[model samples]
Target: MPELPEVEVVRAGLAPAVTGATVISAEVRDPRALKRHLPLGADGLPGDDGLGGHGVRLPFEAGVARAADFERRVTGLVLDAPRRRGKFMWIPVERGAGDESQPGSVPIPLVERGARDESKPDQLALLAHLGMSGQMLLRAHDAPDDRHVRIRLWIEHPAHGELRLDFADQRLFGSLALDRLLPAPDGIDLIPGQALHIARDPLDPAFDDAGFLLALRRRGVGVKKLLLDQTLVSGVGNIYADEALWRARIHPETPGTAIGPRKARELLSALRDVFTQALAEGGTSFDAQYVNVNGQAGYFAHSLNAYGRQGAPCPRCGRPIVRESFMNRGSHFCPKCQQLR
Candidate 1:
């Protein structure tokens, strides 16, 4: 699965092309890919518009199979720049030009980047989750369809010509959905309703370090487990968790309550440093499954110290790194350096 850095890379690449662009139409090649969408009506047609009828439902092809609601709701809505929180990425609706219910109604304010007027009407966003082998590729409209492409959205940009955004998933674990955009608990940013429980990543400017440290010293769970907890601190996956723990000289299984404030702060700082470096390098890509919108692999995989370095000599200490089974995956660390305390 693509972590925070990987998702951020995709979000950044899609920002310029998708922002202020119009969604011409949507084609669902696979119904399983839209499992997260609203349930269809008994008549197998779109029911009431969940977005308060803010967007007009455009006519869709009746010949197509699968969910037509995804296609109808997505069409005709202008999109804002793609936004991300942790591994979750979404493109919010900038405006519904064809909406005649409220003529000349001001467009809803975008979350985070736009003004925060709680009184504004709710909006919708196209939410995406790249499971194991999902890729979002921006291709020329006439280009050959990517293998295993589950969904395609035809979009037209003001400056750029028509383009196709392909959502391809080899393992069929990823999904796309039309979800409501609601203000986060902090009220500082807007997040898709499905991702509301995810905590802010360490790189987020609003991330509370002091509060996190306080919580870290209270949990009895393993420190690594705590890091992986999306509600506690989102985006620190297995790969980066080991790396950050190595930098902090703490064992992966070290209980969070056993870690003092000084060590907790050090771990937090190490996480941010690792995330920053990974973002700079695009993101860690061990296989072709993970790539940016341009279908380019990240280079951060080459800079890894702990994860996937089993039996390799540690950079800090000369001891060979060991791999241990963890949560159905492998955890790599330097035993000599990161001793259980």
Candidate 2:
């Protein structure tokens, strides 16, 4: 799966090209990619609260109908700057060309539900999650369809002319949806309904460092597992978790309660350093699927020290690195350098 840095790269690439662009048409070749499009309510907003629980559920009807509905609503909406949280990315949508009530009206910003007045209209955003093998590629206006392209958006930008954004997913696990915008739990800013549950990443300026350290000292779960928890801290996946632990010289299986405040802070700093380095290298790409919008591979795989170096010598100590089975995945570490203490 593409992690935080990979998603951030895509968001950055999309910001300039798609900002202020109007969607001329939306083609859904495979309706499966529209799985995340939630049904709307009588008030023209999402059927339920932004939380994942207790919402209007998707039905068992033919997916083509759902795809049609998605296209109908998404067409003619203007895109604002692309935003991201954890591995999720979305574009703030504005009513533009296709709206019948106010054709050619200037685009209005999406207001948070908490602050929105009754007289104002509801707002929506285009949410995207790159499950396993998904790719959002930017191709020419008339370029041939890429393999497994589930959805295509033919958009017109005021400065860039016609452009095509293709959502290609080989495994059919990723999705595109038009979700309502709601105020974040902390009242920080508005976010897509589907992404409301994700916690702030370490790179976020609003991330609470002291709160994280306090929480880390109280959790009874293994330190690595706690780090991977999206609610506890967003964006640190298996690869970065292992590398951060190795840098902090903490065993993956060590309980969070066993780590002191100094050690916990060290782990957090290590995570930030790892993510920064990965972003600079364009993210850790090991295959063709995980690439930037332009289809270029990342070089961070070469700088890894612990994650994929099983049986190789540890860069810190002379001991060999080992791999252990963990939650259906593998955990690699320098056994000699990282102790249970």
Candidate 3:
């Protein structure tokens, strides 16, 4: 799956093309893409899979929803700015004029508001999860569809003209949904209600350094595990985790509680550096499966220092980088510089 940097690249590429564009039409070519949207007003029903108005069972799990309603709700809405948290990306939408408030009502900003004012209406959003092998591409309206294309949106933009937004996923794990945007608990502006539990990524302006340090000390899990925990910190996947560990000279298996405040700060700094560098390089794409909006592979793979470089000499010291089996994943680091506790 694409991590923060890769997802951010897609988000940045998509913002200009899709933002402020009105949805001319939306087509869901595959049922799997609509798995995350619940049927309208189906949340009040009891049971895990209660039958919806459409006679289909409501998908109760995260990222699972009734497909028919998902398609119907998003057809005519205008897509606002695209935003991302961790690997998740979403576009806020405005209802058609008929659904708007009466004249003289306070107009709401298209972007999520900073305050948690329940009296203000929540904005509707189109959420997307790019699970493994998923790609969002902007193509010409007349272009041919890719083999794995699951959803396509025809958008009309005043400046850019008409364009087609394609969501392609070779594997069926990725999905798109219509969701409500609720204020973040920390008073940060809107985030999908379904994604309320996800912690702020290091790149987010609202990331709390003091809060993260306190949580890290309390978790007592392995450093790599804590790094991978979406609740503690978002967007540091296996590759970046390894790179950050190597850069910080900390062993991946070291307990989070065991890391001192100075070391923890160092680790966070390393994480930011790695993320910024990877994003500049377009993210670490080893193959064609991970690409930007233009379908071009990232060059960050060439800049990898630790991950997938088992047995290669460490850039810091002359010692060889070694790979260790870790929680069903391989962690690469310099055994000499990043000694096990």
Candidate 4:
């Protein structure tokens, strides 16, 4: 799965190509790609006849029908600048004045103003989750589709002409949904309601450093476990957790309450540093599936200190890195530098 850095890289790469562009056509080749938006009724399956009672229709139905609905709602809307929080990315859609009869008349402005009025419900958003093997690729209009391409969109831009945006997911766990934008507590006008529970990543401007440190000291769970909790702190996955802990000289098994204010502050600083370094390196890519929009692998994997280098020499203390079973996953750390209390 792509972490904060990798997702941010994708978001940054896509902003230029899709922002303000009108979606000419939207197609979902796989019904599973929209499973998240499809709500299951009491029967554990889609309602009878695909349309539920009282004119309420389930979003998840026959692939062709769902695709047609998606096309109807999003065909002529202008996709605003994409925004990201942790591993989730969404593009707000604006009902432009562009003529539906004419295919590419909408002009995408270079300057991006923030969301319009929060009270007015004139906008819809497209939420994308890049599951384990999901990739969002921007291809030429004439490019061939990859075997895993699940959703393809024809976007029209004033400067770039027509471009094909492809969402390819090999595992079928990734999804795309059309959701309503709700006003966030922090005054951000365009946060999806489903993502309101997710805490902000450290790189976000609204991230609360002091508040996180205080909460970290209060949580009685293991330090690494707390780090992995999305509610406590978003975007710190297993690999980054080990790296950040190793950098802070804190053991993965240490109790969160045992960490005092100073060590807590150090851990927080190390986390920010780790995320910043990984972002600079374009994130750690150990396999071909994890790549930027251009299909380039990240270089941060080579710079890792403790994540996958089990039995390798630790950079700080020269001790062989140890791997331990944790929550059905393996955790790598330097035994000498990060001793369990």
List runs of model 3 lying over 4 Å from the truth.
41-65, 98-120
Q: Rank the candidates by lDDT, best first.
A: 2, 1, 3, 4
**Candidate maximizing lDDT:** 2
Against the true structure, what is every candidate's RMSD? 6.4, 3.7, 5.4, 6.4
Cα lDDT computed for each candidate against the true fold: 0.81, 0.83, 0.81, 0.79
User: What are the per-residue Cα lDDT tens digits for candidate 4 across 44-156?
Assistant: 33222344322243345455555655555567778989998777789998876754454433322222125655354435588888877778899899987776888888999
Clashing pairs in 1: none
TM-score of each: 0.86, 0.90, 0.86, 0.85
Candidate 2 clashing pairs, residues 3+ apart or interchain: none
Give residue 276's lDDT in candidate 1 (0 to 100): 95
TM-score of structure candidate 4: 0.85
Residue 72 error, candidate 2, Å = 0.7
By TM-score: ranked, best first: 2, 3, 1, 4
Compare candidates 1 and 4 on lDDT and give the better one. 1
Clashing pairs in model 4?
none
**Per-residue alpha-carbon lDDT of candidate 1 for residues 89-166, written as tens digits (9 for 90 to 100):** 899985557643443333333332246565655578889988777888999889987788999999999988899999
lDDT of 2 by residue, 180-218 (tens): 777799999988888899889999999989988999999
